[model samples]
Target: MRADGSERIVRCNEMMLSLFQCSTEKDFLELTGGCLRGMVIAEDYRQISAQLGVWQREKSADAHYLDFELCTSAAHVRRVDMYLRRIEQDGEAFWSIRLMDANMRTLMHVPGAMDGLLSRGTFYQEALRQAMKDRDMHVFGSHCPVYFNITNFKLYNASCGYAAGDRVLSHTAAVLKEMLPGAILTHLAADSFLVLAPANRLTARVEQICRRINHFIAMPGVEVKAGLRFFEAGDTSPVTSSFDEAKMACDAAKKVVKRSWAIYRKSMSDRVVLHTYILTHFTEALQKGQIKVYLQPCMRVLTEKLSHVEALMRWDDPQHGLISPAAIIPVLEESGLIHELDAFMIRSVVKLLHYQKENGLPIVPVSVNLSSLDFFEMDPFAVAEEIMERYGISHEYLRFELTETAVVRDKGTLRQALQKFHRAGYHVWLDDFGSGYSSLNVLKDYPFDLLKLDMAFLKNFNQRSRDIILSVVHMAKKLGIHTLAEGVETEEQLRFLRSSGCEQIQGYYYGKPMTPEALYAACDKGTYSVESRAESHLYYHPLRGHILRQIRKVDASQTAQMMTFSAYGRSYRVTMKRIASAQALHIYQAKFEDITEELQYDDKVRQTDDVMRNL
Candidate 1:
């Protein structure tokens, strides 16, 4: 249109005519009745004129913008970005106008040569920006932006080739255009699309479009699942967020065979946020002492002795208190952080051993778990040896527990690593033996000193389960491997396991997992034993009178709070005695006595000789 008030028709370029699917300028002009105003929709003509009037009145001579729907010569309507600049030519005023088809702009953003649709990356980004700007205005009536993608496009490309994939994309675009006329459509990425239309219309029509797209792309070893997320007019979130949410939905859809579509939800986003938080803070948490090592004692069922303690990792964040291993270990494993965490646990166990020796406490062998990633991080046995040696601890004081999953992940390397542990004189136990499908096979191949049975077998106590456990125990014993029943929380279960010849039992019924200090304290108390006092006079009121008589008989110059007592015809050692005065004449106070077993070998030998002589 001319800048002069006449609004005269100007020359049309051949390319512009081609965009309207016209062969020649004459044909296009005839279709529009040879008038520029006739090319625009009748409802938008007045606004276009008013905006033009404002542009002319300003006298800035700058290019003015008009975004309006154009009714083209081919009887098709498209949104257009028109740049109108005022100019003077041949001593007269005119307007140089450039028409940019919104559809073509979208197609331009696509990477390849696309016809009849916008697939250009630049166009897709611009469309998103424009959609966001329009949404911010809150004037685009009840419209929603929907994002979708072809789920199996990669498989299709891999099987059929890129040319066939391109055709599929073209066919999909054509179907979408026909189904959703006047929609603001943009091809987002390789196989994803964004469409803006009336909310009610989109919700009603998206399912049908998905069916058509799936059918169009259907082939042997090829399927198309569409995942869609709608950004409703009432939603205050920006349009850019739609892609991520929709992508998540699409991924979720891909996991289900029967489902072809999924909608984004808040819970999915929350899970993503949590996973990201754990991954981001893991290293910092380890350095800040939030990650700790705890011990759970594995006791021998036959001897009721503390065989060893298993080292388990725990996280206690200052903000989110006590994150469970079930919650944090997966993130660590997935993020490859488990390797470093496993190393840290090994070092912590070594430090615990060192601490026990320094404090004159009994040094117990501790077993630490290793991840499959630990092998990739470094030589597990070598690392363990290095830490133990650095702390001046022996390899005999440490053991390694490897899960069936970790061992099966890389059998060759892990087997080699396990062999190295054996060579280093450290016990390598296969943990969670029956948790995996390959447990029996793992047992056959790997050289494990012990088999820690998975707790699942004990969850539902039945005769069949019992038989299965008995068979496993029998097999393990035949293979010269001991079995440990984990999660043994009942007397019945403990009795059944003991009868089945399981070597160890570790669970709540025996004891729960405890800190180093608590474990040390329990071990310091040692095992309890029952004895009978043959002489009732010394045993009467044994807590006070007997202990007081023994302490009074001890000479302070000869012994330091030490005395000997006889019980069951054997002597016992009493130490750490304290005495105080009592108000009653026959009563005396005795405190802080430790009575331990002290055998009378000479008395037993003389009794044996007298019995022989009598016989």
Candidate 2:
């Protein structure tokens, strides 16, 4: 076969034609669209190309082998093993190709085969054959199709390297074979497997397999989940459909806490219907402006002003009325539509900022959330930069927020991106810090300007939780990373966060997510004041400590107190009022007004009165 761009077949023997059920070379060429690339199924061609590229990079390796499904002249899909040897003939690159029936190859001879497991193609073929045979047998002979997925497996690979990931996969395959002997099983690509287990005791077997794999991996926060579909007597559904059903069950199992497996039920089909609807209507809905960007204001703890706002997405489907992000995000992520939505959000936020600046409205930095899929689907940094340039908005007014899980995708690439964002004068924030198992590792690896503490810490408020939250805030402060506590709803939580030295607070305590117009109105009405960048230094000065102590010492019964203070050679009058008092702790709201001129005028009047009295 010619390895050149043409993918032409140079030569073939009679056996090759016979295997493809072709009478002559012309028939073979016609069946394969006259190219070597056309021999393998479209889905597997990319994998084969990648493998070949890897082998080419290793110049010492002249020969490589792969197993893939080939389309026959009769339009049948058959698994074949191909041996490709790189050849250079008269300065032209070529490949000497040999094909064999994959079914005839022993498990040990299959290239890159997992231990004790058949390749995906072989397994699917065998499973289908078994299903057909079982159709003729008694109901007692039914088997359950099971799909296993290792949760957060990509994170494991990124942290432990691909070699380690492969070992984990091999170990899992070995465990499944040992536990379900005589059952057909196969490695179905990266951290997922397909197995046929006896209908009886299937749940026990699945639990045992998951336990064994987790034990072998010995990694904290890593576990396996199984989705099962019990085959019934006289059922005629395709084995491929059963595989998909099991996968759907497994996906559902991932969401349930403390459940390692889920059995397929008819009720699960509703999710499929919803998934289809979302994919079908997403673009149209977006075009119609059903999807909107809502801003949740973040208040600076010291200044008690709106330092920034996090842009959250809300979908208002005409049919569905209102859809929560919890329902929409996972679907979009699985279908890779999150990239489109993310890009749209970036554009929306930039446009909003541009509007604010042009309309003479207070413009604070707006943070846009980025999913891990964003990096894989598109160049997120480039997209954001382009949008900012188009809107003529400074990078400083646009912030990027990525969850802890997002950084684990590719630390090296994300690290460089973070550096690029910093160089462009953009602030990068880590959202939901401490929500994952690898929070410390993320902080150590990535250069984030702000850390958004996961709201979970404040959800179940207690002394222990308080201590943990304080420690995290202190640790972030020591690392020179600003901290923001999310989901704060009560004065106790607010007081604790403020006392812990948390720089920012974002949650219902300040305000819930609202439309852009609402946010502008709030600022315009003085419901929330935007932080002044020019006086930002004042919030950090030691003088704030004295003022804070004074507010803390004031009695709750006092309606308000007026006090004069001098800072930076200017006298200011501070008004302190108790906003809330509970559990013996008083929360004070303070307003500061510079009274330099007012005080000087009063002093001159007092002197004039004294002169008049003396005369």
Candidate 3:
């Protein structure tokens, strides 16, 4: 349909030429179906002095205003003009003001693509880390993500051919753009690409955008590792100096994941109180002797004696103390300080190895865990080799554990890396076997000398369910794979392990994780010490005490004056009082224990004087 005289309607791209034929506003309005209010402007008109004014030729100060009239069809265009108001100001003469909308409410600004990118990126990575800790396999975020910075991706070689790699990148990028509206692609050179560029949103908010991107990219069936990096106020790094930082974060993310996309996060200059607390205490713990390595003994099923030791790292924070490796490793990984943590753990283990050798106790295999991020971000095999050689320990003396999922990714590189360690005389342990996506295939494909049976399998194993447990155990035995039963707790478990033909056992039932000195002494004892302080402490307190201590501090806050908090594993209620003498608040906290105890007491002490009858 054509417009009448007044209104100019753009129905489609191709109708412009026919649209110009209707010259008059009334004709334009008539041709189109739209209402028009009175508005007028005349453009490009010429005027001349061809007037029959013989009378005005005498002494006329008349000049013809011959100019093209500026015309616009917009009505009330004058109302858009700006005006400065003379109002009270402390140091300025003008007061800035914005008129309210028809609803008389302040307008809310919508964040653009940049803000979305930052926020989603943060959320995606944090959620990924959380998922890993929780062992929530196939933990899909609310949003799938776009993947980028496939560093050494062609290194996969089998599934994706070299020529198809570029198509994969472009196809992936295009698919992401189609999935996420208002997203852009920025090439940061090489295999790196920045997708989901947010508008107006701050760098801090980029996590939300990254998460949305991840949500979409993963929805289409294939799993791809996406690397993420986030930039803030002023990260002097060249990659983040401009749009390329996103690509660099993409590149950095590939260090943690070949298929996972990442949002770039520059080192934080500004810190939240919790972050500051973690960082400060972590640094202090590292500096002092507070952070230490303890060994969880792995026993040979045949002898029911020690086979190896898995070195577990623990930290006692100065502020909120006793940080779990589960808690600290993740923060370090997200912060890109995980490499430091890995190095610290390895170095600590190596130091213990040296001390053990010096005392001449005949060291057995010492297994250490490697983060998935380390395999992608830092070459753990290389680090492990160096640590082994530095400690003058044989390859047989070492066993490095990698998650089945982490090993499955870039299997070629991972295999080659593990093979190198194996060749160097170190054993490779496929930790958490029979728990992840591909247990048998992973064992078949990768070179693993030992299989660290996940605690979940042991927890599930029962004499009543002997058929299921025996089948799995027999399978491992037939394959000539050494299976270490983790978290073996009772004598019954030991008897069950022997009956099931399991050759390795680890847990409190055998001997708990011990420090270097305690381990040496216990090893020299000619008997096993199955009970550990951690278990006894855990019996009284399910979680660490230091965590509870920190919860108390939160209640001390003026804004958050009471501590009524619930965590995934624990809950607490607290109150705080400021101590003028100490210049700090004293926090009083009660865990669920107090409430349960009080309830138990209340039931018994029904009346105030009822205690006499009970006595």
Candidate 4:
């Protein structure tokens, strides 16, 4: 304590620090970089004699540089990042810094670090970020006393109206500011505010502040929401992409406990983090024509023909590299965005269909897969019928395939819902036939025109009996059902289906799913489509695969990285190249941290970019 009644804050200089009351003088020392400089160590006979024998190192008054490093946690690292942000907010320079971990261990000894990029601190930023997302907010990269510790980012009384909530927010912010002077404070949307402070030797000061907020919130007139996010002095990002994640936890809290305050959860995933990024890019790709429709030809193998093409959506998710239907589809489902994807495909297909009809081209039938949810919301017939009529399309030019699951789950209402199309002479094909036993009963009970065999039967071709494939073929034929044999990969399989009297074939060996131009070229000249194909070389290595497989056996992270791009459509060789890259997190980090709308306005990254700017 200073001679004055109020405690004087510790100054950066030793002269000011010495003014504080210390239990022992021995603990007081200046910090200097490296092991041999300004170190406080146990006095040993050999070291004491050696030190006494050597010249005493000069400590210049102008140096100001310390030999003693700060002790910090990963939480403290987050605090440091916040401090930089706070300083930057004040239009101050955020200097690059080398740092120390909890044990006063030198984590980084950057040469000319003040002018260099803050690389070491960046790891903590990412590490703390991941830690927060994974809900392990406790794991910090450093152990420093100077971190601004956030217990939770919760609201005080959301149950109360805006007036009461505003009062509590004001009181809470004031208390934090008073306790943590010169802290970076942000009003992170409605009742939540964040404070970033330097807490070196200020644990008592921080606890007292938390206690004050706790006391203030418990008073009952106005409740408050709060969460603690603590980290070491210097780091990257502590929370998720934004305070919204913390606020989400707060919002969830508001529903149940109606607690005045709660801690923020680090419970989101790196994938989830990346999703926030890709969503924007997908939007941009749609606008910029980067999202192109690749047509997977649903064809007849016996005739070696182009039947019709299923319009599949593909995006080079510039920020995430390439995002696939498999990776992005679940998100679309969650966001109720599957309809938008379907609409995009429908609109694109309508154009192609219009072109085909206009040119008097031999237009075969193409079908699209409808989600069960989508089918529930909008009648499949209506959507298809309207698009066809609008584009001058005939029902013969478009086939509609509903999954067996969609069929069986529909309470037999699809028959009624889709009665107009069937009556109007549009073909309805039952997709993934063998997977669902109920499909057979539905086929018998309902008015169905065609059946597409499930790829599962073909996946087990070397093992399954020919009788199994033939039974399906013969039954459909006897029932006046036209059959499309899917997953026909090999020439042998194609010939076998032909001899067995299958009506159509669609699979990689016939020629992979292609665009309209690609469909024309590959179908007309049939070796393979190289330009837009995922051959084994894109991801798989023959000799390299063997080596990588061995390397992957020992490395879990590398093996996990390998699973992202899997070939799904290949019957024999569905060349699995991921529309998105294997390194999703890395891609997100690169795309986000440095994003500017003026530079690369990736649709997925804009919001994240905005939030990161605030962070």
Best by TM-score: 2
C-alpha local distance difference test of each model: 0.68, 0.77, 0.49, 0.49
Estimate, for each residue in 1-615, the C-alpha lDDT of model 1 and write its tens digit. Answer: 576655667778976687556788887765554454555644355567667778777766787787655544433345577887888788777778888865455345333333445454554565466676666787543555566678657788998899889888877777778888766666755677766655565655877887787787877545555545665556666554555566556656766777766777766565444444455466667889999888888876544667678888888888677877876776666545578888889888999999988998777778888888888867777778888888899776787888888777774888877887888778888889888768877988898988998898899989988998989998997887868989889999987887777877888887787888878777667641111222212322344354545556543433336555655545545553333222321222222222433244566788999999999
Residue-level lDDT of model 3, residues 108-149, one tens digit each, is 322332122323234334434533442344422222223354
lDDT agreement of model 1 with the native: 0.68
Question: What overall lDDT, based on C-alpha atoms, would model 2 receive against the true structure?
Answer: 0.77
Model 1, residue 249: C-alpha shift (Å): 5.0
Clashes of 1: 10
Tens digits of per-residue lDDT, candidate 2, 526-602, equal 99999754334344445656666666556733667666767656777777777776664445666768788998999
Clashes of 2: 0
**305: Cα error in model 4, Å:** 2.2
Off by over 4 Å in 4: 1-270, 277-284, 359-361, 523-615
The candidates, ranked best first by TM-score, are 2, 1, 3, 4
For candidate 1, what is the TM-score? 0.55
